[model samples]
Target: MHSKRIRAILAPVATAALVLASGAAAVTAAAPAQALENGVARTPPMGWNSWNTFGCNISESLIKQMADAIVNSGMRDLGYQYVVVDDCWMNSTRDSAGNLQANSSRFPSGMKALGDYLHGKGLKFGIYQAPLDKTCAQYFNSYPGATGAQGHEVQDARQFAAWGVDYLKYDWCSPSGTIDDQVRTFAKMRDALASSGRQILYSINSNSVHDKTGPRRNWGDIANIWRTTEDITNEWDTGQTNGYPMGIQNIVNVTVPLASYAKPGAFIDPDMMEIGRGGMTDTEMRSHFALWAMMASPLIMGNDVRTMDSATQTILKNANLIAINQDTLGLQATQISNDGTRRVLAKKLSNGDVAVALFNQSGSTTTISTTASAIGKSGSSFTLTDAWTNATTSSTGSISAGVPAHGTVVYRVSGGGTVTPSPTPSSTPSSTLVSAASGRCLDVPNSSTTNGTQPVIWDCNGQANQRWTFSGQSIQALGKCLDAPSGATAGTKVQIWDCNGGTNQQWNLTAEGTIRSVQFSNLCLDVYNNNTANGTTVILWTCGSAANQRWSRV
Candidate 1:
């Protein structure tokens, strides 16, 4: 999957992001201004796509069924607003003069008629296209020929918008080169869409927005949502390929880089979630959904909603997870830690509670005792509310998190405001946390200090660059990591690192009580054989039920 220049969507670490893979290039129009201001992109994008239910067999009449089902199911009111059609709607044949023609047999009524039906139902309609000349299906598309110039690309986008399309799912199936050019091509359509004034929701296929390439591909407020993965399939029967959908690992990997990019106009889409798709255990789907919601990633479903079982519906409609996404503050979640099957992600919800997740990505049952402090809160003992379960939970000095493998433990954490999060950043952030005076140092060695040399743990003494917030158990001093001990290099020694708050330095607290360093990841603290000593030599080890590894900030 090659990425276009414009597509800086998240890509697999090795390949980076393949911008605008496919199902992009359709910009209906700028959506009404009010819709976006209300955090439309913040919540998981609840809706349907043709690929899941209909695949390449899409037709005008079939889309009508999807729209009807969405309206009849009352899911639209629940936030399933956009009814999108994936690939294979294009026809290779042109009329006598060279105009694109609707495949008469498959779509007898034409696209306008279908748009009328969906718009009539009070739901928006989405169409798909690609930056390349042909879609992945080998069907017709727009791309540069051997000459490397988009033959009829710009015109096609205009036509789609003219038909009253609302959402555009652009893809970058077979582009010529570089994500920058791909973005410019999409920009052409984005500019064309401006002529229509539709404010269409632009959703590029996964991989157009690789996080490594830099700040969201100079899109300049063009596209709305960029995919961060390769194509996701709806069936587990498929091989472990791009189509497998987003697992917890994908969310954990992609969300950190993309979180800062989320704003009023655009979002980082981790492709469509495969929660209802088979292959994943129920617990796994819960974990997947929980993480996606916490990260505030786009929530397009790759499952057949028309046949969604109650079990699936229950998971999809969890008011707690949905509320976390709908939270007005609109901050996205970041990974805290993972204990084998157990993984955790945390975000500050607008309603004043921190949304915390204890997930079982392994899909097997497991016990993980997580601490509250790791999830960006203060206090030793406190009461908790299970917003997902719709009931209050027991509050002790700490929380006992037992999650089924593939399941999740989501909480709406609330307590007295013991402290504020890390201080807000100044205009241009710096690597050093320059305190007004002296302050305690974290992630530093027990005692070490030499300018440009690694710093160490010591009580605050009005140090100029020590005061910092351990937000989400992550050091926010200059937005970098105070890495775990012995993790200095790939294997040198772990030490607190510098920052601009990149993924290399984020850590999350697992629901099962354990501390995780975001930068020095997966490895947990192990007390010397579970010894409970002030300086028990916290060797880096996988998370377990050892009491020594667990610590709480009062």
Candidate 2:
């Protein structure tokens, strides 16, 4: 099994505790992140990261060697670029001039030199950092100590860009108490990057993949990518790792996380890929790439790109899936069924067609049938095009197909069918609920014009802002709510503040659609005055349906 690291930072869970304490959890504002360029990913990103095989053992020599390998191995031709360096490159001390420097022992030639080499080799370079004082490494906090430096922090990003960095993996640590601070920190770098006149891709890193915080407004402006898991470990033997493990579980883990994000330029990242690292079989790897593609995730290959085998190459080069992901229209799939396994994958293709995958994960292969009504709207019909077999099938009510154990069948369905606005949903007698969303989900009102004023939740009156949206899976109130005390904790008492479209502002509604904390689920959707007094200070309470705590949206 590959080594999976679960050390990403998390917001405190106390605020969420109050949510469960109240027994009422309702998400009024929950949606996915918007695409980077309003386009979906055609294929999963095809690139290399240093985490899978190298762990904390990476160095300049190893990086260059892998770059050489990627080229010689023909990975570049298959669209793999970006030679990413994970953690451990930072140093315990910065130079006297107040400049953050790379660890000389590990990178003697310096990151700039390394960046030059990658650029010369026709590849991009990526680095990592956290929003808080330190990374999970817990050594030299990037945020300087009492003997402070210019705390603006944009200078650090400039240094990386000056060294020719094309990607930045910004982790959320050293909680400022709100996703806003987390996202704003990255925004600092974003401005720095844009001004650097460099096209550096920014990535946000957090620990939870299933949290239900609302959207981080303007997230597209801050990052090109964001992590949806705490950390992806190497493969495990008994009782697999969290999120989805490498083999067998990749299909389940990866797909479940996909539905939340998966918008256009801004793809939802399920951490790095652990392909060719030996925990998974060739079929599993294919499944990994396929799932990422269908979900429109960035295809960052976590395996040693330089040493990948021929079969890995074949899997990474699935042009059909890649094309679909890279298509200009970035609309991603909304899971028809969020059962995790026994699942269906889908997306709207560029040619105005919808692609879907039916997967049977039960031990015994089973035939799964989905009527048109089951797959889409009630009045519309669609023609199903199976991308897996290159066949076209049509259905008016639903479509059914037989699949093997741990296997899938993908299709492209198109028609002039009507797209139904999703039905107003009903609450289930939920057996399991993960509360405590990292960024407190601001309950939004239909049309409040005050930007700096605290946000309040009115009934679902259907105004653009009140109709909270999600980037990836994180939910966000209109760009007008506040994350109380700036960065709210799980049980952190919340008050509406002016919204800034920051991480603190965004949230992800879970499969059950319960509004929970983004960093943890120990909290639940809560309402003001248990759905009573209009200004009862709505905070996360344990999920229970008191009218004040109850919320519904289609």
Candidate 3:
């Protein structure tokens, strides 16, 4: 996980309006302009990282044991091949000649020997470093050292290649300067690694604090796998740890909008997996895994493989889910619909198959439904194979399931003759309502599922609270209609209420990018006082050409 101290150096949080505006631009130009051709990570890399479970207390013996367990537990044959050692492996000081060295006490036989051992077991080796003055552990745990690769990118790259390093996690610790400077700094290491004559999978953490950079579309040209959000803790929803959003859902929200950036050899990294970590329930873990795989993210497990229970093992070793993740098409899943508690995501596969996920983010069993045509499939008949249970069923087009709360049902849809994928629609029914003036999202306070919660303009996190669906003339979220509240007028704050077909609950999305109240067509949804800060109240005001009243569905 990211250290609290390092996170403090992040630039002031951008308003949701700015985030949504940039995200819109990114999605428009998401086609890979120039991607790294390192010839690695053709599919999302699957492996284990020593961070979520062990943190900085990692050792050579522990890594070796995990490697042994990976093979003995059948994870190796399941495509979990990389064994990564995160921060704190380096000594407090560099050796004579200013060369980085491993802490002798932890790895007495040295990194080269450990790498050789892993290679002998048919696994790859990965290590971590920072481009700044120190690693995260050095700052958070007060580890003695300034062992960074700031001015020694070439030297360190050669050193790691000599040690048989197959992967390098280049982290951004206390990054300064403009985004261009950051890009150049990272690309310098990329070049150095290329010259090292070893194919090292470079994974970078550039937006660790959700800064103003937004989703960097140019990252594909610099690194093989790039971290798209802050570190992930072993929690289900948007839980906070040390004042930072670190839950699975929190990270998922940030990642969902970046689906267009992933391609073969350049995958998105949502940090590492916390599957077997004891912080979440089994249902949540399964959902977490399903979301990651659906997003085409690197599946770097962060749990103790040697001690994983049967349930944990089963979730991690699901062959069907893994197949979707490693699909040769290298396409990430797109959100077909999201009605707060329930969401549907679908990805296109290489063999004329489509992977669909019905996710229930609620607290009770809910019947989520979607159609093959909605997911970009055209078939006379389709075979739906349950990814988890291996149960098969036939369907003409409709796909529905009673998904448990915090659980997901994934299916591989085959027999869809030649797969006629629909053209990307101009507007999705479900979308993040972005304000043109502020660039933030229209959001419900605290992701409340109850009725009568007023909405606001906040930084876009892609959470359920920020997702709204346009059905008929009404805009809805959490299965409730956006209402004008009783005694409605031009200045009334907009709140969500049970859909009653009320005039105040109906809306009309104008071609000019304004959401006008159907009952009061002269009035428009507005950000109170044109404030661009998070938590700004959203109210009804006279329809005008003001930018604050202009909204876009993303």
Candidate with top lDDT is 3
Using alpha carbons, what is the TM-score of model 1?
0.64
State how far residue 114 of model 3 sits from its true place (Å).
1.0
Off by over 4 Å in 3: 1-34, 175-177, 208-218, 239-243, 418-487, 495-506, 511-513, 529-536, 545-554
Clashes of each: 83, 101, 7
Better of 2 and 3 by lDDT: 3
Alpha-carbon lDDT, every model: 0.53, 0.54, 0.79
Stretches > 4 Å off in candidate 2:
1-29, 32-45, 139-152, 173-177, 208-221, 234-262, 338-341, 371-400, 414-554
lDDT (10s digit) by residue, model 3, range 1-554:
46333443334334444434332221222344346899898999999998888877889999999999999999999999999998889997888898999999899999999999999999999999988778877766546664889898999999999999999998876735346667888899999999999999998877443331134344888999887666677887654423254677766655665666789988878789999888899999999999999999898999899999999999999999999999998888877766556778889899888999999877899999999888878877999999999999999998999999899999998886554444331123347788888778898786554567889998775545676756677787645679987666888899987666778888887777778888877889999999989899999999987788888777
Q: What is candidate 2's lDDT per residue for 1-554, written digit by digit as tens?
A: 11123332434333233234333434333343554441222334557887667766778999999999888877777677878887778675567865677878789999999999999999888886655555645533322221211263666766776898887776654323345445556666656666665666777664322222212233554566765433554442113323233333433333343354555557666567665777655655666666666767677777776666778777776676667666666655555542323566556666766666676645567786665554444456677766555677667757678776656677766776535324211111111122232223234332232333344443222223334433343333322233434545444554444433455544545444455555444555565444333333456655553444433333
Q: How many backbone clashes does candidate 2 have?
A: 101
RMSD of 1: 13.8
* Best-to-worst ranking by lDDT: 3, 2, 1
Residue 43 of model 1: what lDDT? 49
**Weakest lDDT window of 10 consecutive positions for candidate 1:** 427-436
- TM for every model, in the order presented, reads 0.64, 0.64, 0.85
